[model samples]
Target: MTKRIFRAVFLVSALALAVGLAFLMVVLYQFFGGQLETELKNEASYLSIAVENDGAKALEELPEHAERVTLISKDGDVLFDNRADASEMENHAEREEIREARERGYGQAVRTSNTLAEKTVYYALRLENGDVLRISSTQYTVAALLGGLLQPVLLVLIMVLILSGIFASRASKKIVKPLNELDLDDPEANETYDEVAPLLGKIRNQQRTIQQQLSAAKRQQQEFSIITENMSEGLLVIDKQTDLLSFNSSALRILGAKAAPQNQSVLTLNRSEPFRRTIDAVLAGGHRTELLQVQDGFCQLIANPVLRRGEVAGAVLLLVDVTERIQRENLRREFTANVSHELKTPLTSISGFAEIIQDGFVKQEDIKKFAGKIFDEAQRLIVLVGDVIKISQLDEGCLPYEEEEVDLFQAAGEILQRLHDPAQERGVSLHLEGGHIIHQTVKPILEEILYNLCENGIKYNREGGSVTVTVRRGEDGAEISVKDTGIGIPKPQQERIFERFYRVDKSHSKEVGGTGLGLSIVKHGAAYLGAGVSVHSEPGQGSEFILAWRGKK
Candidate 1:
């Protein structure tokens, strides 16, 4: 702005100076021209008087002068010339000055020489002796005059230009100083030119608008940050340039990043192939979902593009921890295969015995044994099917049972009575300990849990071992623990004991003649009653399985 002002000021100043100088030169030239013409008239008058008094001899006697003199007769014959031979001079009667002087008594005219470089001013007087006397002076033309004064004119012009530039620079700064010092915070309050007042008012209005927009934007950013920061799932916002614009702590944790990565490429957080593919697909205006290994678990990455005017502008990425879901899926597949294998064994034996009888390959004396063996395998198959159905019901969580007040000690006694024959056959004694403790729970699920635990104890116990079922009131809940003098589980296998069809002693399982799902059913039934079940075991020592339910509200 200062430079513009300076340029404008300097240009105007220089132009004005040029015009003034030109006008001055023109006035001086005209003034000098008039003076030259007046002097010629005066010289002509004096020469005419001298010629009239003394004739040709008086002109001849004139001293050498800068002015030219000419004498011509009334008949237009040149009688005398100061700088030329009289006899060789042309007639002057037809000349403008001579003709005018013949008629008007005196006349003046200016004419350019043949070369057009000089102008001669002629003044003629018609004398009484019937002759005209003329005086003329030659001067350079206006163009020639200016050319001769060019050096001084240029010097003055340079000096004027220099002064103009200096003054213009200072003037421009002075004129713009008020604007520069204006308080933008209060533009209308500034003491400045009235011409600039409207602009200041606009500036003030614009400032207000800008401030309002900035405040609104800041609030929106804060709101967005709060929402994203509180999310449990990981979130990421990226720009079209692949730069990470925003993220949450969950995103950092999911990516296993040690620190918040600001203004960096999203790939810096996780460069895995699936993660990169998800980002790339979303950036191309597509939606993508990929399962990636994150740390020791699994994450489901969902990516979607952000669009503007039907164009992809950026992307939004969401990460969900699917570790538990994936583990459940794997367990389901394993359970299906194990159930098929467990059922196949019993079915195969039943089929073989039936085929042998149909083929008449069994003797009459062994018929009873074959039939009894088939009955045992059929019973095993039925038990396995029943257990599978129970597990399915627990998983579905829609059992036709309601919560009721159940006495834990009474429930343990009932379960022991049902297993009495099995315990006696296995030579394991059952003991009911602690007083009756009432707990609010689904009665059917609780009974199922207690039954499974006791059954498992008798089936897996050593000969002459004892099973103790205890019920007690805990600080926060009612507790039921089933402890057994059985072949203990190893520490490494304890964690997996609750898994369906899992067994610590595979060889012992065949002799026991029970589905390897008792502990799994115990776990599932406890869960349905909103209780927690855990086990403690050492390889050579007996095992303890404890189930605890929350106190009534």
Candidate 2:
């Protein structure tokens, strides 16, 4: 703005100065030409009179500054010349001024000299003797006039330039001062030019609009942060340039990133070859999924390309924790293997004994004994199959019995009565204690729980050891405890005791007359009833399994 204003002022001033100087020079030129013409006319009048009175002798008496004088006859011949020989001069009768003087008594003309450097004005008068007397004076041309004024013109131009520069500087500053001091943030509040008010108002409106847009954007960013921070799955967004655009807290935790990873390359977060390849494939418009073992657990990384106009613009990474799922799959595989082994053992024995009887390999008297052995093996197979089916149903969370209110103590007593013969056979004493404790649960699941606990107690007991069933109301809810004075489980193996087919002493599994699913049933049944089960045990101090009905309260 300052430059433009200064330039405009300077240009206008220069143009005006040029025009004024040109006009002044033209006026001065015309004024000087008129004065020179009048002086030649007067000089010709005086010289004509003097020459007529004294003839050629009067020319010698003429003043020195009175330039060239000429005498011409009526017959077109120069009679005498003061500046050159009369014989060598051109015919004066044919001259422009003399020709006009012959007809009009007096005449005037101007012409340039032969060299073209000087201009001469001619004035002539016809004397009383019928001859023309002419006076001429040389005047400088317009070029010569301009040359004489060059120094003065240059001085004036220099003065004009200086004045214009000073004026332009002051004007430019004056024009820009208000704008420089203006508070653009609050444009309407400033006191400035009325012409600039519209621009200021526009600035104010745009400022307000910008502030509102910034505030809304900030709010949106905060909402996105909150949602992603609370998510359990890791999320990441990356651009096509391999720059990370966004990273959530879950992603940071999953990648074990110590700092926020925005605007960085994905390789900086995870430099592993597989991770880099997965990102590359996704960026190339492909979808990829891979499992990575990270600090927290196994994470399933799923990279999906984000498309724009049928081209890959970026990608989104979803990280799901699959550690627990992998563990459960492994457990299922182990359970399948154990089930096949356990079922095959009894079936093989039953098949062998029946085949021996059918093939007549045994003696005739031993046929009944072999048949009895096959039946016992078949019964063991049936029990094992039944336990497998029950465990499967429990795992699927399918309850075959309806829930109802029942006395926990009564349930314990009934389970003890059912296990009395087994306890006696094992040489273990059975006892029940505690007051009545009622709970609302599935009756069959409760029965299954109590039956399994008591069976485990008697099955793993030492000879003459006692199994006690106790039920009572507790602070949290109903408590049912089955403690055994038996060959207790080792401390290290206690955690796996509730797993299906997990036996503390595999060598004595058959001797204890169990399929190793008794405690597993207890665990599942208690879980189905919304109860908690824990065990207190040491290697030689015996074990106490406690089932607490926490939901009943």
Candidate 3:
């Protein structure tokens, strides 16, 4: 705005100067032209006084200025033309100055010379003797006058433009100063501006509030980082631009990656099909669960919304390490299937034989043996079904639980008495390690876990090998370990040992009448009781299974 105004002022100034100069030149031309013509007439009349006083003899012998003296007679005839023949000259009576001098004593006119075709200005006067004296000169027109002034006019214009540009540059700075001072970087300039004090004050207050908010946001970010870093699962946050803005250590470890990735599209990240589908689902407005199963194992991504002002801003993905859970679920499914299949065989056989027996299709001597086998199979079926139901109840926390102080030694002795027959038949030696103590709770579950663990140990052991049951109170918990000198589980199969229906050797296990629920029950029982189960085993080296529970004193 200021520049425009200044430019307009300078242009107007230049125009005004040009117009004023032109007008003044016109006025000076008229005044000076007229005054010079009047003076020429006066000089013609008045200089005759000096000539007359000097006399005709003096005029005839006129000094060096005689060239300007034109002697004319009273009767419209030239007496003596100082530079021309008197007789050859034309009549002067038709001349404006001569004619006017004759009529009104003096007059002036401009006309083209008859001989030369050049223009001239003439001044005339009536001499003392009624004779006329005339003088003439040429004057240049206005165009010629202006042309003569052109150089100086152009020089002045150039100076005016230079000064105008300098002033405009300075003025521009003044106008732009206020805007620059608002940056708050130049202390001196900022201090100099008090016009916008109110606005600056408000900005300062708002800045303070913003600073506080930024500090709070920073704290929240740090807190979230710490929480996710230590978490057992991975977490990923992506923005609307599909950039990976935030993540955690667990996420890095799970993805086999390191370093923080930001400002990159989701496709640029881990690009497995399942993971991409999960990202697409998140980009859409839906909660989805995508499971990625690879060679190492399974990972479950839980995508959720990050909302701001009731609108989704981005997505938060939880990368849960579900290898264990998936394996467990698969085991549960297999367990159910196995239970159904195992029971179906016995039931079908029993139904078929009973139907035969009912029809009296067998001999009386064979009836006892058939009945005995049927009863044994039926017993086995009952045990298997009962064990499955018990495990279900234990998992659901519906199993009856009672805590008490009991003697570990005495409990072991009682359980050993019941397991004696199985142990002897298998040629397995049983050893008791710890004495009685007050640290006991949930006696039934405790006994069940011990019995099932020991049974599995003895069942899977080598002939004439040993099964040792050691009950001791650890610093934080009660521990019971079942160590067996058996055909030990391989390193790879150790993880699946506690899974339902999993047998080290299916043929060997069925021959020994192993229900496969014993170890499964032990696993579920110990877990339901808020305990941990750890196993150490290698092929041909026997296995040790340890269960840890909170000590009850």
Candidate 1: Cα lDDT at 466:
91
For candidate 1, write residues 366-485 as lDDT tens digits. Answer: 999999999999999999999999999999997888888878789889999998998999899999999987777888778888888888888888899999999887777888889998
Q: Give me the overall lDDT of model 2.
A: 0.87
- Residue 262, model 3: lDDT of 65
lDDT of 1: 0.88
Listed per model in order, the count of residue pairs whose N, CA or C atoms clash below 3 Å is: 0, 0, 0
Every candidate's CA RMSD: 5.0, 4.9, 7.1
* Candidate 1 residue runs with Cα over 4 Å from true position: 39-73, 76-89, 114-116, 127-130, 175-326, 349-376, 406-439, 457-487, 549-553
Ranking by lDDT: 1, 2, 3
Candidate 3 per-residue lDDT over residues 213-304, each given as its tens digit = 99999999899888888998998889866788888888777776666566787556577888888788777767889888745778888998
Candidate 2, residues 307-331, lDDT tens digits: the string is 9999999999999888888878988
Q: What's model 1's TM-score?
A: 0.76
Q: How far does residue 313 in candidate 3 sit from its true spot (Å)? A: 14
Residue 269 displacement in candidate 2 (angstroms): 3.9
Per-candidate TM equals: 0.76, 0.76, 0.66
C-alpha lDDT of residue 494 in model 1: 87
